[model samples]
Target: MFTFEIFREEVITCYKEKKQQHKLYSQLENPSPGNLRNLCLIIFSNGLSKEDTQTFNEFFNPLNQSNELETSINRFDLDKLRPLRNFILGKAKNPKDEVVKLLAILVDFQPRPYENWKKSNSTTVIENDNVESGEKDSSEIEAEIPVNTEQAITALNDANSLKSNSKSKYLVVTLGLVLLLGVFLFIKYGTLQKQCMYWNNDRYIAVDCKEKIPGSEVIALDEHKLNNFRRITRPDTLSNKDVSRVWYSKVNNSVEFFTEPGHHPLYDKPLKAVTAYILNQHALEIKN
Candidate 1:
């Protein structure tokens, strides 16, 4: 009994109640299966408990790569989603009650009736009405019925079979073309790897090597030298000049040092003034 419109309304209501960002909400205003899937992923990632999140990742990750439910609503396989519904309900407390309702709608989703079926039924009703109204001789009508019925049924069956075969062929050809296009794009663009770092005046800028800055002298990319850059803790014994010579930036638990004051080549964080700490306790000295 569930319809796509019902699912859409439920999701839109949930989004509003949660006060999710306007940009994402705008995307849901005219939802496609692709965008709806993306929104569901965001919801799952943000709403689920740690244990539930892990289970969701394990169950849904493989399906994400497949073309299982990315197409038209009629082709959607609700059986694939039933196990997820069961798992969500099995939990002691349902933290994601909204997700449970959405899954239920998907599992119960009914495809709309085909137009041909409606036309066939309408035609049958008209024929029956004419017979009942005594518009023709009863015997004559009965004699004509068997031949007309047989021919109509045979023609309908043939038309349906041809339609089914044509659709199958179209799907196969479309898939092949898509596959070919994907491979072509990968081969062309994927090979040109973006340079991650470029050396600037006395320091390296953590930017794409291809980035253009007018009048800036950029040296050749040296990944080995960049990788070797490490933070050296300033010793209190050192002069102010020595401390100024090295720039530092804290990266997680560790601090990274550069030869000159600039942003980190990897982290992109602005370098800070060096602090007085004994080199022996903090880091090993790296010779320039």
Candidate 2:
């Protein structure tokens, strides 16, 4: 009545038990050829009556090695048990009864089945817990990255502050040196000064502190454009005419250089007034 797959499963289970018990030995409770029939009959007897079932079950029940002797079945002995399985269905009324008989015989000899189930399920739970712990470790690793970045940014800000302060000091020193040089040039060669005034109606030059209009075809120059020439000793040579000279130095906030000794003359154009302006300057070496 049983399929080939069901019969194969029983045989495999029987073989695994035989491996554990050591094939070379025989157990005390293991039924020999004389009692093998009697053992099958006992399990088969369960459906027959209550009293017979109890006595038979206690007779052939497999015992654990700690408290009882070991029994083993080789390939030949296990094959021998297969024939007894057929007898179990001999008087059964239906296929369902036959299947029930097979399951009862296979499982009856297994002791402490609940203990095995509990251990297997507990091992699965431990494996699942290990996976969750790995996820927690990964999140902690991600957390440290931002902490490392913040520390780097703090160090960079400190370094930039130090550099900016140093640059400010250099700019202050350079500006102070430039102002000092301009003052020194002003005092040395700026001894002569004069002013030529021009009215809205006409222009004139002051001769011995007297304003006079030119009676000759002499060009006029303004104070704004008369500072280009710096090395002329005589003012008359600039325009080939009689010119006058004056020194407005030691006066009211005034300095000048365009002056002639004889008469104040005019030029064809207001050009470079070549006089000494202290053009050459000595360089100073910076000591580190």
Candidate 2 lDDT over residue span 1-288, tens digit each = 234344434433553454354321121134344345433432342243353333333333323222321122111245444444343324322333223333334334232132333465577788779857855654554444445678757655555554565467668878888888888777633532333333221233322223454554323433322322222333223331111112112113322223211122332333222223211111011111
Every model: Cα RMSD to truth: 20.7, 57.0
What TM value does model 2 have?
Answer: 0.21
Off by over 4 Å in 2: 1-11, 14-111, 148-288
Residue 154 of model 2: what lDDT?
A: 68
RMSD of 1: 20.7
Model 1 TM: 0.21
lDDT of each: 0.46, 0.36
- Per-prediction TM-score: 0.21, 0.21
